[model samples]
Target: MIQMKCRVLLFVKKNMPCVKMMKLSPSPDLNPLDYAIWSILMEKACQKPHPNVESLKRALKKAWKGITLVDLVKIVDNFPKRFQACIDANGGHFE
Candidate 1:
């Protein structure tokens, strides 16, 4: 009876989710929006004549409600060359 109880306890512990206990350490000294804005600015900076950072920021703020992940992906897809260049230069895979 004791062996059976131990086995059941072990199985329950093994199947339990530890998501709440997972550490969600934010990057030191940087806010979450900083990363997103920086990425957008970097991509904009690579274009000819460069883009207005304030205008991009304004657009982002205004479009925040309507934009979704699929919209962002479509924007990237529309700029295949630039997107590919960004991925290659940054050593990151987007797809």
Candidate 2:
């Protein structure tokens, strides 16, 4: 595991110099958008069979248009509570 981590860090430092300078101590949580908006979008987009790439893209676009600022703000507002839950759980995964 230590060797694997070292290899990963080495690879990051060599190939992903932009992210190499980022702190390695604490990991980040999942994006709130993934938890909130993405699920709704996926549900709407996949509600019916697309049958073609264009249809799928159209469905996704429709879903994207459905997202409102209020939805985003609600997700963003919940971030602190979600993060606190993670901290309370000693960095374990939280809903």
Most TM-score-accurate candidate: 2
lDDT of 1 at 41: 47
* Root-mean-square deviation (CA) per prediction: 16.3, 11.6
Give the lDDT of residue 30 in candidate 2: 44
lDDT of 2 by residue, 11-58 (tens): 556765554344323434645555676787899899989899999999
lDDT of each: 0.43, 0.67
Model 2: colliding residue pairs: none
lDDT of 1 by residue, 1-95 (tens): 34543554454356544322233225311222333434564454433442687865665554453444553444323443543545676844333
Q: For each candidate, give its TM-score against the true structure.
A: 0.23, 0.63
Clashes of 2: 0
* Lowest lDDT block of 10, candidate 1: 24-33
